[model samples]
Target: MFQSDFLRKFRILLVLVRRDYALQYAGSALGLTWMFLQNLSLVLIYTIVFYFLGIRTQGEDPLAYFAYVLSGLLFWVPLQEYLIRGTGILTDNRQLIKRSPLGPEIFLWIPFIQFLLHWAITAVPILAFLLWAGKLGGIGLPISFLCVFCTGLFVACLQSYLARINIILRDISPLVRLMTQFLFWGLPILYESKGILGKLNLLNPLFYPLETFRSFLLSGYESKAAFTDFLPFLILFLAIFFLSRARLNQIVLDHL
Candidate 1:
């Protein structure tokens, strides 16, 4: 019974994932092919432009610099999706959510599904390049994936509240999008950290994990972070997740 139930839920989840992905490129003629290339094209644009600039994050090796930009965009794009799309999720699907009692819980997985798809579509080439560049090895690759998985959970927990907050405030959606633009510059992806901003990088909750993962992937050592760097963020986010989850249920039931 349990196995059957799990399988049923799994199939439903897959269908939802497919539907959402399709909706994203609904009017496009090529559809899935174009959907697959969109994220890769963005990464390629950044990689080519930066690699051509003669800026060297990994000594003078151009390939390593390519890997650097590739890895940054590979992760950063989905995070932007989570913040922007996730905040408006409730409002976007008010029709479905209002009909199904379990709506919010299920819809919460949509952003995560999109992340997995984006990663999966690019995973082969990304892993191959990392391998060819000697940036990943046996357990190292799995560890990198672990970092990505943890990040998925972090964003889901975060949006648990952000989604609810937007339903109430409405302005938060635009604000999140605007701030995300600033955050991209803030993250140490495009340039090396320097001076006051570099010092303040430690305080940004997203900074440590991303920096640690980047350093670990490139050089196999974490120069920018310790475990405790993101611990407080995790703790606070979990607390907010639980409280917000309860309140969200209340708001949906009582108001929406």
Candidate 2:
């Protein structure tokens, strides 16, 4: 039933994913080169800005700050893109949804596939830097690599539900932006969660997964809290998805 309902459109979905991915960089001379440079600029900007302030990532290590920021981006960038793009999937593709027989859920998956592609491409430099620094092996590469996509999938599912809800409440778009701004500062992406941020980290859903990636990839810090603390949120989203999915599909196309 699940396959029939969702996976039936797999081929069409892949075509859409490919089209969108290509269109994303369309008209740009450098194309994906610009994307790599953008990622590198982010690392360089943070590294230089923080150096002046004497902000040590975990210790006196030099590349620790770069690795810390890069690992956090591995999760946050994809999740943020999912949140912002997925929220508007229905509205953005209203005409396409109107014409296609596929469910609105398929539209949600497009940005996800895009996220995965972007992450994999952008990560090449970070991986090379880590390999050069000899911190690559300490990262639990295979497991952490798996976690990255799984995290993308988990966030995608949750955001798909949000995409539907945003259709009903148009104000949700701005609210999501505001909330993510709060979350961006709240999550220890550019900095470690210490003192106030550490205590308040429990309130932000993105914290655990972001921290889990950072812990393994950057600091060799391992904790079961990623599972224990983060599982409930995932389960809650799955529950919401299951409960509302059918109704959403039935109304979404017509409403859009």
Candidate 3:
């Protein structure tokens, strides 16, 4: 019974994701093709500036640098979707939430569902490039995806807390956007990783997964240090998730 119920909801989730995707591109001329083109264009801009203008990170190899930037985008794009768009999930769907049989907490999964879609879209070219460059190892790709899944769990909890706060504060949306911008720039993608910012990655949780992704993509390997980083980050993520969850009562959520 439980398995059937879960499958039924999962089916509904897929339908909503399709509807949302269609609605987003409703008025566009190219429609779905723009999704592919948009990412390609963004990749080109970064590649041209950093790879062509004599600026480089990770290495001087064109393929490696491009792969490096693309790898960073893999983690960053979904995160932007999770935090920036997810911050507004409750407020934006308040009407549906109030009327729907399902609770608002069910809607929190929308951002995460979208994250999986966005991550897949971004992963294609990275996989292609790594394969073309002769860098993709069997385990590396799967492990990288596992890292993404692990980190994404925290995004849900963080989004839930932030969305709740946004209901009362109203400024969290913009604050989240602004802070996300800072977080991207602070990442070592644009600048070389040996700088002060790279050393400061111990505090930046995403850095662990990003670095792990890059390492596996580049060297086809992961280190013990990668495992070490994930342990502490996992602990921190679990603490935040439990603490935030305690506040997400159904009564308060419905009232909000």
Candidate 4:
């Protein structure tokens, strides 16, 4: 019974994913090209600033520094977009949720899959640049890539859970934006994690995943230390997933 239900919902998720992709760029002058344009502009601006400020990594080469920052930006951008958009998935689609036969969980998956598609599209240029610039060393590509995937999944599930609660209390929506802004600085996206890990920086879970990603991609070195750091995040994600699933129906019904 559960398997049939899961498949039905998964099919609905795929349909919603298609709908979101179309709606996002439908009728725009530039269409889907805007995705690339936006990312390119942001990359150029950040690259220039970091270059002028002599923000190169300590042990990694200059090209590697660019690759590091770019990779993190790639993942971070999608994660942020998903969180922001997913926060309103239920509220914005309240009518559909109330009237359609589609499960609420399907609506929750739509933004995540849409953001994942965007992430994949954005990664093409980044990977090409890394290869051309010879910044990618084979040290921890697989592990780092896995970590990136995990981060995306973890963020998606976390956002879905948060969105449900946010609907119950509208105040959480703004609070989420505020928290994400603070976290952007707290994470070691532009700087080395070693410089700020010992103090209050430990409070942000984003730090470890960002650092682990950069360590493997930019430095071409794999320290067991990096993987060790992600253990806590893994546990936290699992706990949240189970707890959220347990109350999933109740939350949806209450909001409706």
Candidate 5:
């Protein structure tokens, strides 16, 4: 049954992904090129301002800061995309959920897979940038790839659980958007974790995955250390995933 459900969900996800990819370039003059342009512009603006302000590390190379910031941004984009799309998934497909034979939970996977596809596509430029900056060496490659995959899984689960909750409580959706907006600054994306934690002691759990990811990828830090640091997050992610799956059907039925 699980296998059958998985195959069904995979087919639905593929259709959604195709639609999303088309929609992304439907009316755009530059088509899919806009994706690279958007990311490049943001990276350039961030690198220039941070460099001038001397916000980067003194000991590290100049490009190190750019690599660090880019790594975090890469991890962040899929996470943000899932959150934004997942929250609205149910409402947007209320007709299908109410009438179709497919499980509502399948809809949750749509946004998750869509974000994963976008993340894979975005990785091309990120790889080029890393190679150009001469940081793509040794342990960085494997650890960074692993960290990205793990972090993506965690975010997918987090967004799926949150989507169920948001459908029941409409206000929760906007609150999530506000929280993610605040988190862009609060999560140490553009700055070093040490500096952020030094200023604020009680760090949120949501930020740890990205911190661990950046450390492994840009800082060439040990994966075991980063994984151990986020053990609590892994535990929390599992608990949420199981609990959400267990109750998702009932939750969707009740909301309907």
Candidate 6:
């Protein structure tokens, strides 16, 4: 009975994800193509500005530098979308929570699925580019994806807490947006990772996964340090998830 019920819920979640995806791009002139276009445009703009300014990674040719930036954005974009879009997810879906038999956790999956879809779509050209540049590796891709999945799980746990808080505060959504912008500049996205930023990379929660993804794509090798750095986050995620699971339903009911 439990297995059947779980399967039933999974089907419903897929429906919700598909509907949300369609609705998001419904009125856009370019529709889903805009997703690719937007990412490409940003890459081009950043590459032009940085290249003209004579910023180059040591020993890396121009193509490698461009790949580094592009690879970094691959992880960054999805991470950014997850946090910003998920901030008010529960509040945004209050009606569904009130009416639907599905768990409130289903709302969290919607944004994650959307972000993954966007990332998958954007990765096609990136993967092709890496292959053409002779930088793609067989083992690196799978390992990089595993790291990304772990990072997503970590984000989901924290987002669960934030989503619950946002219901009462109402200010969290804007704050998260502002914070992500600051993080974008603070992270080693445009500049080469060296000096103080390189030292801090070991400590910054976002740096490991970003570098893991970037390094794997650019050099066909994953960073052992990144895997090690993620252990703390994994521990934190488990603690938060266990603590919050019991109380989350109650909080939602009180807020609704």
Clashes of each: 0, 0, 0, 0, 0, 0
- TM-score list, all predictions: 0.87, 0.84, 0.86, 0.82, 0.80, 0.86
Question: Which candidate achieves the best TM-score against the true structure?
Answer: 1
- Stretches of candidate 6 off by over 4 Å are 1-3, 50-54, 57-60, 220-228
Error of 2 at 207 (Å): 2.1
Candidate 6 lDDT, tens digit per residue, 140-218? 5676677677678778887887787787676488889987887787677776667887676666667767777766566
Candidate with the greatest lDDT versus the true structure: 6
Tens-place lDDT digits, model 2, residues 1-256: 9888566577778898877656678998997678678867875776576544546544555566666666776667656766887788777677877787765777888888777777776677777777776666464577677777878877766787788887777648887788778978878777767787787886777777776666567545554245677778888878777766867766665567
Q: What digit string (tens of lDDT, one per residue) describes model 3 on residues 193-251? A: 66576667656666776776667655543432356755786677677667766865554
- The residue-by-residue lDDT of candidate 1 on 1-256, one tens digit each, is 9999888777777877777767777998888788568776876677567677656555656776677777776668777877787777677766777887566677777777777666667666777777887876456566666777678788788887888887776548878888888878777776656687787676777787687667656655355656687789889889899999876777754545
Candidate 3 ranges beyond 4 A from true positions: 57-59, 220-233, 250-255
Residue-wise C-alpha lDDT for candidate 4, range 1-256, written one tens digit per residue? 9999888778878987777666778899997789788977877787776644546656566666676678778768877777788888788777778898765777888887777677777767776777777776566456656767777777876887787887777537787888788877776567655654544456677766766676666545443234456578778877887788797768666777
For candidate 6, what is the lDDT? 0.73
**CA RMSD for every model?**
2.5, 3.2, 2.7, 3.2, 3.4, 2.6
Q: Give residue 53's error in model 4 in angstroms.
A: 6.5
Which ten residues in a row are the worst by lDDT in model 5?
219-228
What candidate 5 gets wrong by more than 4 Å, as runs, is 1-8, 20-36, 51-60, 139-143, 195-202, 222-229
lDDT of 5 by residue, 1-256 (tens): 9999888778877886666567658988898678667767766777667555556567665577767777777788767767887777877677778887776777777776766666776667776888777766557667766766767677766777787877787637778888778767766667665654634412455566666666666646432224455577678878898888798769767787
Pick out the ten consecutive residues of candidate 3 with the lowest summed lDDT: 217-226
TM-score of 1: 0.87
